[model samples]
Target: MGSEKIRRWESGALAHAATDPFGPGPVPWLRGSELHFDDTGHVVPWYVSPAAPPGPRPATSPATTPRPTAGGPRSADDVHRQIKGFASTGAVTPGEAIDFHITVDPPQRFGVDIYRIGHYGGDGAGRITTSPRLSGIVQPAPLTADRTVSCHHWWLSWRLRVPSYWNIGAYVAVLTTDDGHRSHIPFTVRDDHPADLLLLLPDITWQAYNLYPEDGRTGASLHHAWDENGRLLGEADAATTVSFDRPYAGPGLPLHVGHAYDFIRWAERYGYDLAYADARDLHAGRIDPTRYRGLVFPGHDEYWSTSMRRAVDVAREQGTSLVFLSANTMYWQVELAPSPSGVPNRLLTCRKRRGPGRSALWREADRPEQEVLGIQYAGRVPEARPLVVRNADHWLWEATGAHEGDELEGLVAGEADRYFPRAALPEHQGRILLSHSPYRDAQGAVRYQETSLYRAHSGALVFAAGTFAWSPALDRPGHVDPRVQRATANLLDRICKRD
Candidate 1:
């Protein structure tokens, strides 16, 4: 639609953007309590910008084609037991075939609708393709070996050969059963083509937190599991590794996935030249971070493989700017392994122990997160708190209209980070603490959070937004802050314009 319409929708004035009339009827699996989806099963999609559209479009579709909204039919609770699936790989390059292994309870037919997520004139997503009704069968139960729950569903229910001309972006495969149940399997379409920015989806962390089956009995993630007595098991007793061969628990969407969606909507609305990749791309050396001016980790990117860490470090050393829009980034060092069939990087392994020669917390491994991010995970905020601005006159805040000590309500929350003076730090020519926010932790003790920006010796700008609320503040309803939006734009603009 028009820019004014997009703005009105973002401000919650427009009730709903006209639906793409091409997709299937509302499915019960797509509905959720998130405000993005309205009562009528249509998605309002997240934030929008009033800026002029970028002159060029990606190769996926022409301007005349109508784009689908970000969501399909979903249930209010997103109960995913009836139908669920997972991609053969977290990402697929153009022209490559990716398999979808699905399980339909009680055996039923289903269809997979693929949608590329973006700003799409405020539609939020464009329906790329839909699969023919495929014969779906219940896959075998997941095998729990060494505390790892893996479903190597070798059934290969459906495979799609990505069109050679498809655009590079995040995509989702919506599994809608014949009975109206629906769920989501998220993946990325990647390419060697270079762009101004590279957005890395934290698929590793997504899988790490995925307690598939979530059914008390057969669920296990790297973070938690069930004991024999049926009591919850914490990290100390949880699975040491997790496999990507299974679908996500509950609604099948990763936790904090909306944060990434919010960012994609806001970024593409401005027509920023953006490319997409999965975290595994960095781990497998499939991505050359130097090809882009900036590398963005949009959500809770808490897990990192050694190779993934090296790639970003080398990219920054070569002057590629880095933007981390959420907190608790790179706190754990993980290792990626192949699945049973020898496919690469399908398994993530992490032992949450602190000691020398351990592949666990990076801080315990002598590589503190602050060494690169300029701040490390501080403590969890029991509730939302104001983000108190500090460097109001800094260039990043030029158009934000914020003043020193101004509190951006409820912007420092969830997990938070701060500068640790005792930690090993990277060399920076200059540094600034942008926000100093204080909130009570779960222990009832007050802890401070800080947003930071620092210039590496190679002239690359590294920004750490030290709070999980930062990304949601950019677009989510009730959390959007104009100051946060403008400051983010300023940071990104500087990244793109810097010599």
Candidate 2:
């Protein structure tokens, strides 16, 4: 920005900051905020004056019991008896430490092994960090009413401090016991630097969909259709609310790994200058979007906070480009509250459809996500379909000799998006539809989904892939499309050159 423009922007920001009673620090949780059950049977937010801290960790204890009676370390049937665990924080920067809480069927000595995830080889790649096997006593964290959403601090099994030399990327800690039972806990080592690209992981979406509880069959999540008890909800029956203070389920594969990692592995293979941050960073206003040429969202970034939305909008206004390599981006609104575990931004609260914390479709708020993403979630695609190039001449299709009539195999699958209606669009933006795929909506009516690009009046460029499968198709063998890879390269090359 020119000196005059920079000065004006800084002045305006300062004035805005001064008016915020919390100053420029991380926005503290509203004092005395608690979930109050009302006569309407809704869990509502009732803010009161300052109250005592919930504590540094959840106030519950793991049900410590000896290892399960079932035995057979080498037996395939015993797989279900393995241990499950998760870390307190999802992603942490080097030099910081994280706590791990575990639940063991048969309480035994467990070990924590950390590995950095990447495309190291065809055999698979994840280099073990120098952090030795972190051993601790494991116990069962039984599922009861008081401890459904959040797990007891239980035992702080292991606190691993990331060394400064650890590379910035996704890391998973493997928790194994002497009995041959194992599970995974994932975390990311983040770096703070000016880079060509900033990768924002959808931690919010991960926690919302995570159904990791002792009795997994009935655990809650933003996607689950039941309440804490086993009763089903009527509408989006999925738990409108969820917390991040518990472990994620399923072999520790962080919420369907194929979507996000496919893009990250491919990007890393080419050595793109990349920095990392969880979506919470955007909410906390910790990222200076102008410092990076582009911000990339990999996959399933469904839930978002108002602050995160504002941050991205501001960044785009300042000329920072954005690439949503996934569909269903910024669909629902949510709020962040301090975890009863005392971790800020750890509790994701969204009272979907009703109540004070009701998370209506962003469009209903007159803040349609499509205004920023050019394409909004239309509906789900019943099956995989070909993505027909609508604009062969667009710069994004520079290589691979794709023609307007050509269809990239299965590039449009799962959920997809289409351009928002005229009344829902923001001002001074020009859109270029790239690909269009037809699918059946929930109503059984034929609908078309569109992939698009738009340049804001401020000259910032935005690209939307218009499908959730775009990232997964990048490197997954059966789904990998060379055309998709080339198109992605074109986008990244242009953005990097702009820097």
Candidate 3:
């Protein structure tokens, strides 16, 4: 009944949305009447727009990949002039060789250069590796676009091994041609070194929400609310499975932009001893949480595999601290399968149908996310709202001098999480409920967004900010709240010492 109403409501919205005032692009508010319009009358959804305008961008060394601007690639003409390519995998361990599939228009010879993202020089230092290992120019294979997916992955042009000296962090490879054209392919280099903190990149969530359709034909994503042509899709009409062989349509890919980079810039600037891994690392048992004192989830991490959830549960029991700095985490239950060529964790499967089958919602699967997160996804807050502090006496708020009922400006924008009833919880004192902000849900019902924290019997500490915008508030010039920064630092400092 709920699905039927949503479908019918969406149909009526589409009829009216066809005449969007902005024009024929993606109807930003096609999901419902909820939308945020900017000064120019353009739809600027909170999820896409950052709460704070970022500070000066890091400097790109002449030897490394050129960074993409806030505004995406200039035009089709501009893309052709710049070399574009993708790595075989999203991440690679140190000393492991990865293949690069390159496409150079007019079929030219291109070279590859690599750089690790860090604050080596300072806050604005983008690519820290001043001298990167450069590869010789090799002629690329003839350009041939994939028939099923309209992407030019011409051929495997170069295979490069990451040196042992390369630091573990986000790395970008610059593909440069003789004509001075340059494009970047970003990937993470995982580190096995024992560290106090483990930052898990939500690459799985990044790929699940990627709707990079081929030639504008079929839309692909785990989300079931909308179809490819900007029309509302019924519960069973959405794509159940999506492949990882396609390039991300969004600017500089999905996770590399707003949420993940915000945390990266702030964490690196503070000189935290951090290690990196993809979300799949948790599922594959590659991440032994016992080795690290804390695990950090930075962005919109929505999907979770059963194995990954169990791993985190055990980590908490074993006294490894955990922090979720974003909202809508562990809300969807997805399965990982091998690609056509047998690459593990290459395909994400999420059949969102209700009852007796593969249901995407963990709530319906008899495994509520609140069992671990302490809060479940409530809904999205279309417009920005201030995060009202409720537990100012908590240690997380130390040194910030925040008082109860004080509101942090626009820190609760985008999707939010709320404490929900659950069957099981570790025996402890009443959880420290943090922020409580009121917002209207999709049904136009008034609800309060909640951020929470607690400690298990094993002495493991867990913290959830309950909003997707928390990371962005850490370092953005205008959006940076001293309270938010101080709170995060307090937690990090305490977690490391607790180890």
Candidate 4:
């Protein structure tokens, strides 16, 4: 794969290029950066740099220092109305073409700058390529069908033929209008290449929480919706289905996206052999979990399809270690269906409570998530609380200097999980409860949270962090915990067989 020649699309034609674009070399642009508007109302490149002598490459492999853009809206209420977009798919392999469908509010020119998210000596991300200025238009208003908002923007704003040399990782396309408004569309580059660890991004859960069009008038998520009387409805009354065809409302970035990015930065900095994929890939049978030594769920992975659950179960049975870095995993039972245009897995349907005898929760369906996770959703924390260490002698806490009954400040918050003593549990040789933190719920009820690790009969190890703060603590500013970081590294080192 290292000797494969890199290719790019130019003026609707394929052109040959160097083998490793990120290697030590002059590095030709994917498409020349110099641009001018042509008579046909299209931007065209006016110059291309000639190949030059190769020099010593940077210390980093394939990452860039992203150029700063004007700060845009911070939330849905302040959304950048000037421009927004969504990718045709959540993940694409190298050498495949991906289409970007965009909408410009007042019909102006816009361009997309691509960047790969990673740890580049703390810069966090690097620019990959930039598209020529494209003519944008006001796409048709999103259509609402059965309480689902979908913007099937058929207009192809830009098509990127991903270079074969592009590394497999998370990438973001920044859509910027001529007026300086910017938004982001994130996608992952995946391949069949095997790695020590497989990182599954919680894309399904992201869509479930997305309230697109956040206009305060028309937008519905699996968690909240607006009634005809202009009142907010809770989860029970929210939309039962969600489509991935619309941009994330507000900042155009999904909730908890930063958590996954933080983990990526921390893990990549250690030079871990990691492969990336979307959660949908697991559901569609596209990812072979057994090929990797460990499978990692890095963020808020709450929703899970039956297929996804079965795949992981089978992988665990075959001795593939599992790591759940966030809480509330595999809580819902969902079904994937084709989009209106026949794209597979574009629509996610989860009837929270279909009828008197049916439910979307795996536990209610008699297949408790605890059987696989070793812990179940306990309660939501009203505020941050200390995480009390229970199994201080466990290998997971090695070199952390944590003593028995030690409390890590503010490590427990958001949703959490706990070991259910009387619940259906999987057959394991040994089990250890790592944390025993108690927190107050929104209803003022005091509940206990527990982080757990268990060894399955097949020799597979499953670790559940039991709190949403685990990933954030790995790299988030103001939340970095050296003890938590050391414990996470200890766990990953063993799972990846690096120890």
List, residue by residue over 253-345, the lDDT tens digit for candidate 1: 776777787788889888788989989999998889998999999988999998999999999999999999999999988988898889988
List model 2 lDDT by residue over 170-197, tens digit each.
Answer: 7667665767554567677787767899
| Residue 14 local lDDT, model 3 | 21
Of the two candidates 2 and 4, the one with more favorable lDDT, higher being better, is 4
Residue range with the least summed lDDT across 10 consecutive positions in model 4: 13-22
Relative to the true structure, candidate 2 reaches a TM of 0.79
Worst 10 residues of 3 by lDDT: 21-30
Residues forming the 10-long window of minimal summed lDDT in candidate 1? 19-28
When 2 and 4 are scored with TM-score, the better candidate is: 4
What is the TM-score (0 to 1) of candidate 4? Answer: 0.85
Q: Write the per-residue lDDT of candidate 3 for residues 33-105, one digit (tens) a residue.
A: 2333333334443222232232322333453224333332121111232355566787888899877765556
Q: Please count the clashing residue pairs in each candidate, in the order shown.
A: 9, 5, 0, 2
Flag regions of model 4 displaced more than 4 Å.
Answer: 1-80, 228-230
TM-score of each: 0.85, 0.79, 0.78, 0.85
